[model samples]
Target: MERDSTAGGAEDLLLEDTVSKLRAGSLHKHELAEAMEVEQEGLVEHQPLEQDDLNFEKWKPKPKPKRTLHEKIDDLKTYLWNAETKEFMGRSGKSWSLILLFYSALYIFLAAMFAGCMCCLMWSISPYAPTYNDRVMPPGMTMFPHVDVAHGFDVAFNASDRSSWRKYAKALEAHLKSYDDGVQDRRNINCEGNTYFMQDDLEESAERKACQFKRSWLGECSGMKDKDFGYSKGKPCILVKMNRILGYLPGQGTPVHVTCGVKKGSTEGLGEVQFFPENIFNLRYYPYYGKLRHVNYSSPLVAVHFPSVPYDTQLHIQCKLNGRGIINDSPTDRFLGSVSFTLQVGA
Candidate 1:
């Protein structure tokens, strides 16, 4: 009986403890709710009551109203002309003068620096000799009577097309005009062929021997024989001349000559090519002095004739300078010692 009564009392004590713990948790929640409500009320009172109250508080500012056109014009006028500050374009007269003086001094200093740099560069350069001759080594060769020079020395024309052929003829005439007998007389010397005309120092005459490359050497292609230089007749004339460098000498007596042929494996339309001046750039004309030394210097020319070119077909022609000291083929240089040109004759 005593054990049963003790068990009942323990169970009642456990139930009372649980009920007290639940009541305490409810009181904590109610206190937290009151604290949160008090904090919210305080925040609300601190907020801006009137618009004037916003002067001291941080908040999103109201958007400004759009300005009228007249108001904007008035603002612009005020910016341009402020009589009180005695200013124009937002800058006072004194400020503008100071800025102008600063820029003027800066520009003057920069100009002086540029002039000094140019003077130093010129001092490094030699007037008598070239800075680098790698590109100009063995010199360059040029083919005259160039037509349709869009890329390198390409000539493309329709034979039946009169305008196209006429353009080519005119180009040839203009090129030949420079090689006329009267022009050559003024600038060239009656050089002795088959020998190198070498001049070590500037002579009293101040001239070097310029080879007389007569138009007669060109035969039918010469402007004298055919005014169109063979372009009208579908057979075109090409004149090749080497660019002269100061004190450059080719192999003696061997002579640099042009070797022209249709590209290998090409169509057999290109036939019986003829070269004038015997396909030779004679050694006598070489070792040219500059324009300053030789005032009337003329370069020697070799004329090439395409006797029969198939109509309506393109002919790939290779014209190479064959001689010692001349680079025949270079992958890096496209137009160093030789020149390649395309000829498309259409009917």
Candidate 2:
């Protein structure tokens, strides 16, 4: 009985201790709740969503607009063309400039093509310019104006008898004697323009030789020499000589091709346009034209035939030492040395 009573009292004490601890824990939790409530007194969330509102202290920026290809290209173009020149000129101002640019590009492209073609064209195929190994070309240079000089002479002789040869020689002798185109006189009288007439100077003198002719061979200089300018019963060769370079006045026809044979024999049967080339200066600075930069080797012959040609070939060149210093290579030294050669009929 005493033991049962003691057990009951112990159980009561244990229950009281448990109640006290629960009370202490409840009080701590209440203090925490109160602190939280105090902190939220002035702040309020206005969200009306059913779910708990999320913290939105930071905001995301919107994405940049996408650019189109055309728009991007337009912007680039605008930036480029906004220069004062383009803007002031506008479409009209640009028209001429654009045309000039286009033509320039076209001309450059064509020049490249022409240069490429130069190596291939039979007439332009000169083994001399690139392959020659001479400081100055030898004499007797006008032998082969074109390979046709021989063939043309052949055709001429075959067209007539030895009398044609006699006539040609007599005409040649007389031509050599005259001061200037005296043989052209009788030539123009009888063989006037129907077939081929001697130019006015050719018509003016029976005693002078302005040009030469052979009946049969042109490509290979034959009959008169191993080679002739052309082979024709009615062939012609003209000569024009000067002590110095009289500045080139525009001519009427045919492109003048220059060669490098200064020696006398170099121009045997071919037309010898003798000139002691004392190169002239001040031509470049005149500002009227770019520069008098080429040798018009065949102008006299062409002028003899037709009289209204203009602008000779403008050779492209740059200054460089010709084995001598620039001082040694002055305008006087810039001789268009023995620059003469033959070409087939009309070339």
Candidate 3:
């Protein structure tokens, strides 16, 4: 009962002091109203704000502290010397050795597999004959005095231009270099000009008689007779050689000849064309067996001459090779057994 009286006395003194403050106008009317509102709402009394609580800068996000070089080194050292592992750099010696060994083994296995595949491929392929004769079926034909071999039989030049005409002459001379007598003697023999020379075995002489394709047979265009190859005289000569395939024969006693003429509308621009050595590729040089068997074998050549051509005009000429088993009319094979060239002359 005495403790209750003491508490009542203290509460009374507090009420008396508050009322005195309100009467003296020391306490604001809003404060008195707030105190009454708090008592009526039964809300807890608000504590006074601390200096730190009032400061707004303390509420902002702190920046991350930058690590110094020594701190970074220490962290690296700690990571390297962890409880479970110790490493020279980033990995343990054992880990590095294992990685190297795995890579070496993988490389060795890959190399062996590649070598085995190459061996299998080589075993299936033949050194003598091609596996697929896609381009070799009809035999590809080649022609000299070609402006560009990549462009396929398209030859054009100014008649008065020495440098332009000399290119063709140089090409012809280089092509005929393999026909030296000493070189021909090693692989070729005297063949009967009338018949096809066929050899079966390597017993007597493995070489078939290659026809003597003398440079003089080209007449005035032959380098032996005319060194300029008839280029400067407005008469440019062209040589054609058929690509040889092993065991290919044009047939028995069927002669292959080349025929050249101006195209339909180009006759006015170009005059008559003449062919040398009777305009034929004889059967004696048939069935060319690579460089190993017939080292000095020469393909029969025909030189076509454009005797006269008018100045400042382009002439289209078509040269057709007439023979058995040779394709002359294939649209895809423009230069197969026949070719077309445009000639231009200027003063």
| Most accurate candidate by TM-score | 1
The TM-score that candidate 1 achieves is: 0.71
Clashing pairs in 3: none
> What is the lDDT, from 0 to 100, of the residue 289 in candidate 2?
13
Poorly placed runs, candidate 3 (over 4 Å):
1-85, 149-161, 203-212, 251-253, 266-269
C-alpha lDDT of all candidate models, in order:
0.78, 0.33, 0.73
Residue 6: error of model 2 in Å?
A: 97
Clashes of each: 1, 49, 0
**TM-score of each prediction:** 0.71, 0.15, 0.69
lDDT of 2 by residue, 1-347 (tens): 99999999999999999999999999999999998887776344543544433434334576789999999997777765656456533454568688889999999999999987875775644322323334332111111112244443121222144443344344433433322234334332211111211222433212322222222211222223422222242243323222122222211122122322223333233333321121121112111111132111111221011111111211121111111111222344332222233232221
Task: Give me candidate 2's TM-score against the actual structure.
Answer: 0.15
Model 1 C-alpha lDDT versus the unseen true structure? 0.78
Pitting candidate 1 against candidate 3, the one with the higher lDDT is 1
lDDT (10s digit) by residue, model 3, range 181-257: 55555555756665556666664335444556666656766688777787777767888777777767764458878
lDDT of 3: 0.73
Clashing pairs in 1: 159-346
Most accurate candidate by lDDT: 1
The true-versus-predicted C-alpha distance at residue 292 of model 1, in Å, is 4.1
